[model samples]
Target chain A: MKSLSLKRLLVTSALLLWSLTSLASSQFTGPSRDANGNVVPTPKGEQCVEPTADMRANHMKYLLHKRDLTMYDGIRTKQHSIVACIDCHATPNEDGKIVRIHDDSNQHFCASCHAVASVKLDCFECHADRPVEAFSDADYDPVQQLDEALAHSDKPHALMNRKVQ
Target chain B: MSHLDQETDMKNTAKSSAPNKIDQYRRRFLGGSVAAVAGVAIAPGVFLQTVNAKPADQEVTANNRWGLLIDTTKCASGCSDCVSACNKEHGLREIHGPETDAQWIRKVTLKNKSTGHTINLPMMCQHCEKPPCVDVCPTGASFRRVDGIVLVDKHICIGCRYCMMACPYKARSFIHETLTDQLPHAPRGKGTVESCTLCVHKVDRGDGNTACAEACSHGAILFGDLNDRSSEISRRLATTGGRELRAELGLNLGVRYQGL
Candidate 1:
């Protein structure tokens, strides 16, 4: 009778464990999609450098290894670069706004999974979250450019005349 | 076999083996030549492409010692173009005053008390061969690259400020507040010491020039491989000569000043 009761307890605990994992898995909504139902676009290439499952499991390891190589050895390969990840993953929303990495919403690629996993991402604090082109040259004032050009120009008078023309 | 028969047998074996050995050597030579030809055919394009710029996969080696030659006489007084260029390139903004602000590069005006003669030059991390900062740092965060670029590895930097104290030029700066939107190439944050990276990103990209040197309209700043005898910096240094700041310290600085 004691053995039978122990079996019952084991069964119940196994069921509970199975339910708990399913519940947790259900909550994780992976990558988000836009209003048009389009997934994140891989701009540079057709797909990721590595397979989806491998990248999901070992992206951090790849990034960490690449970071050391870049920081110490100056090996700037795009294969496992954070810049490449940001460029590809940080897609614009329905409103065409690229969400910041630290945003509360699940729109940001790195932040979405990190928020669910309860991992604090401080990379965006120092590194740029958005792609280089996201910050457009439109904000760069022409007057300021001309001023800088003249200031640094060996023949300032010649440059000024060219700008005036 | 008898002694004479054994001798004849040995002679026969040697004669036969000699041709086989020669044939084996000939085959090896032909295979090697083919491989060498293929290597030469494939290597030149790759080598020429990476002549100025290093390939992304390649590690920077001591073969190239990057440096700058700043002609102080050509550096105009009150012109802070180089400073602005550096700030823009590294995304360093002036949030605080001079005491607290992170100045990677600054315009230093030196006036001789005796003659009243003044000189203006941009001062920055000397990129010393034997950096005092590297020596004093307990964490091994302050390091010099194989290519002679001195750097602070923020990953390991404990914010000790020992390097700052050890530095003779006062080149390093500690971030007091959290920073945002830093350049992808130049990742800086609060509680870590940073200085001029010598536009390492550009160097890696094969631009072979720094923002400050590129920005200087007066052509005062020249950047090149100090080790390369053909490089402009080396040629100029060899002919006209340049001096390091605090030469008595024997740091063997990468950056040199002309007309100091």
Candidate 2:
């Protein structure tokens, strides 16, 4: 009877592992289709979410807060939501790419779809979309910030909506 | 009071003093700031330490007084011209809730939970004179212009959120990804915090005039040289009872809020 129980458990674990792998593979396939059932490689377009080095760093931290929230898949509860929108949405290169030599906010990815749908878009509703030079705090690495947040979350070190001078 | 004697006396005093009374106070205040950041109360009259040997070139008003005036009373909550214009002028991604997205300007609909009175107001950077963000920036990447425009130097930013913590209005955001260039004005980069600058690049050119300020169908946002007596911003200051947020902090905020 014990041998039979062990056999059942092993079979169930194998099925779970198999299903997880299958889902991961499929997520990258859809939302990017070519005319003839081919996979579209450049879904993000020539432009991407554009943040300055500093703002991107901060955004990286902000992204962490939303890490668990970005599962975009509608079917799975754990599926992330926030995608590559931040890329090329904030600051763009002079040619509309993001780089050290150029930065601009008057560029974005919404027009592609909005034009097709003929929908007038409200920009500020979703994006702060400002230059990197506007804020007093646009100069920190968010990955480093993760450490701070972690530190702050610890006992005797927490700060929540705290005021600074 | 001969020049050489006075200079010598000043040096002696400097050598004798540990720090300026303000500096000592600021240190205590900075220490308390940590506590305050930890949700503790700070004793009154404390301030952040001034940047040592910092060039005065960064001084605002000494160069210019950049400011914004929003007339909430005239705001038509349902109309979103400013929002649309902002998108048109600055290419952006999908619309996001107030809690996310690097939005420089946004209309927040607030309903008084107890009173059931709802009010919608456009919000952006306050541009405080005593900006907490400036004090909290570890790299001093965040700074104010001589014209009172607060901005971040993206080149120098390390993406730390000290300034994010310093902001009282929750008016800042960090960039998250790389970008594609399509528009000349869309600011796209990676790793930096940002907010509205009253359209410095556009306003400086004497053309763009802030997209939201010009797009408001109801004249809710008014932009002008606060220094000019004839400017609409100055006129409103004289006639309107607009108030600043946390006014008691003495930050000399550039943005003014008037309830409709």
Candidate 3:
């Protein structure tokens, strides 16, 4: 009787440990991996204006604030522009063409994060999810070009990795 | 002096001091304002901080009332450049027939029945100060900007089409089908009402010109700040005294026709 009870306790402990491990692994899964186990390439930028952890937590707030400024004040500075985000985070498809945020087959940066968070984003319903066709020629290295263009524009930022004023 | 004489003297002194007190307050107010101005001049950043700290995020202001002066005499009968330009600017492609497709602006030809005189002019959202569309909106989706430009807030629009019915010019159009390849500047969605924003995205970007006005090779459209008495539109209106379509309505339309 004692041996059987001990065996039952061991089994319960093993089950609990297994379940906890799986939960932790699932929770810690990186965003660069897709559902099909494909490792999508991480988007390139020297550094985000804010730290990665800060951005992960407060990106939405920053976007909302910047959107109001751009919409109301006509302040189209590249620091927090949604167009700039699309330019930087757009991913290529199987055909090596840039995919938009609304594409079901492939997930772009915003869609990927939004899917993971299970958040509904209505922006692409009206606004174009992809960097416009005007920038298609420079799609090869768009992030750098966009950063450079914004840096050289009339409302220039300080530089890469600097705080956006 | 006796006690009555002393009381009277005190009353007189009090009367004299009242004006002095008011002058002191006025002096302090002026001094504080002057100091503020001096501080703004010295740093200049203080002024920027104040501008940034403004609670209301007003992108458009009433200081510049944008208006269009259309000289119908200059408009070619068959030319549709302004319409085409507006369509291209707003990404208003026709997925459906003319009955369903969105028309932000259209060229209308009117004939006088008695004289048989015909005139061709482009008709769009008159952008009236007293827009009937704005009045009938149940959801307050139709709103005018501080700058006197009226727009439909598509995000909140319920697709009721009440605004369409209320508009006198038949300007607003309802999107029937899903749209693709939409311009980044203009975001049109299905089941929402849209109209000519006067190329508001371009205007907000400080372009100070509308697509229709720019596309008019015949120089029929003149876009300017109507509030400025010296502006080109104001000067032209002063000379020609352009007629507002349906002037009896007292809508005070921003767009005026010179040769209607």
Candidate 4:
């Protein structure tokens, strides 16, 4: 009878764990969508450097790695750059105005994902979200162009004036 | 066999069966990888630059000693153009007045005690070679860059006013209040001591002139590489010997004042 009761307790605990996991899974949804049921943002490039699954799982880790590399080592590869991420992700809406990440209403790319995950984004507290220069239609990859120009050109400041297509 | 040798052997085998479709794909992959490795190996300079944190063009070296030559004779009294320009550049416009406001550069009028003559000059973080501020800082946040530009790296500054106390010029200022709408280039925060960076951002961007020098209508401020003898400031300094404030200290200030 004792052995039977112990087995029943084990079964009850398993059921409880299953219910909790189901409840947690149900609460924790994927990326949030807009009112029209479409994903809020459509980033400009064909796709990111990494696959969607990898990016979803490890985007912050990639960003942090890039940040350390750029900050300490100055290894500014075009891929995995926060600047590039902002260039692609921080697009203007139908009204032609770009929403900042600080806004309470989730509109900005970083803010949208962060708000869903309940992660506090403090990068914008010191760093600017928007790109300094307004990119034209011709300038698809300004960061890469700038990097190349900086590499070749002796006058780094002059490159700022030159329009790269 | 070594891993690289084994990999090369595999590639050679893959290349031998080049006519086969799957082997052709494998050979192509190996060839592309080999080419990529060769490319990295062939361009050592480019690879080194790619690995470096500082951009290739933005190299701050000991050879280029950046400094400012202030022509006090040309600096007109009551004209705060240089001060205003610096304030505007760094977005130090949040006017709490001189008592609390962060002053990156300031216009000072110095009077000769017995000579009955006064000279106007723009005083700032002197960018000393042997800065006392740097020596006193426990966190080593107050530092002189490679190009003789003194800056407080706010990231490591623990709000300890030792640097401010050590600074002979009283150039450093502690942010007393929370800041908002800071300029993108100059990131200033409260509880951090900041001083003139000599516009290191502008220097890094290869902007030859500082805001103060550019803004000075009277041509009082001259900014250039002091180490380069051919530089305009160096030529001027050579012609007219400049004075360092508290020359007794032997700090070897980057900022020099003529007709002081």
Q: Against the unseen true structure, what C-alpha lDDT does each candidate score?
A: 0.76, 0.53, 0.70, 0.69
lDDT for each residue of candidate 1 in B1-260, tens digit (9 for 90 to 100):
43335336545633333354466457656765875686589866442222558888987866678999999999998788888788788877655456787889988989999999999999999999999999999988898887899999897898999999999999989999887767677889999999999999999888999999999999999999987777889999999999999999999999999997
State the lDDT of candidate 2 residue by residue for B1-260, as single tens digits: 43335336545533222343346456555755675564334445543422212232221222236677888778886776776566455554332233445677777777889999777778778888778898888886787764567777664568897888889888887766553332433444566787776765464444525888888878878776665555667788888767887888888888887884
lDDT of 4 by residue, A116-160 (tens): 545687666555565545433223333454566568878745436
Candidate 3: docking tier: incorrect
DockQ of each: 0.19, 0.01, 0.11, 0.06
Ranking according to TM-score, highest score first: 1, 3, 4, 2
| Pairs in steric clash, model 4 | A73-B53, A74-B53
What is the Cα-based TM-score of model 2?
Answer: 0.47
**Most DockQ-accurate candidate:** 1
lDDT of 4 by residue, B1-260 (tens): 43235436545532322244355346556765885687588776443222112363333445567899988899998898777678767767433457677888888888989997998888899999999999999986777765688777676789989998999999999998776545556667888999888877677656778988999999999998887767888888898889888989999999998886
What does candidate 4 score in Cα RMSD to the true structure? 16.2
The residue-by-residue lDDT of candidate 1 on A44-162, one tens digit each, is: 45788876544644466567767767876688988789988888777776578877776656567776555544457788878889877786552223345456656776873433543
Candidate 4 chain B: worst-modelled 10 consecutive residues by lDDT: B47-56
Q: Whose TM-score is higher: candidate 1's or candidate 4's? A: 1
lDDT of 4: 0.69
Candidate 4 share of real interface contacts? 0.03
Candidate 4 Cα deviation (angstroms), residue A18: 21
- For model 2, the superposed segments whose C-alpha errors exceed 4 Å read A1-165, B1-63, B95-99
lDDT for B179 (candidate 1): 79
The recovered share of true contacts, given per candidate in order, is 0.46, 0.00, 0.24, 0.03
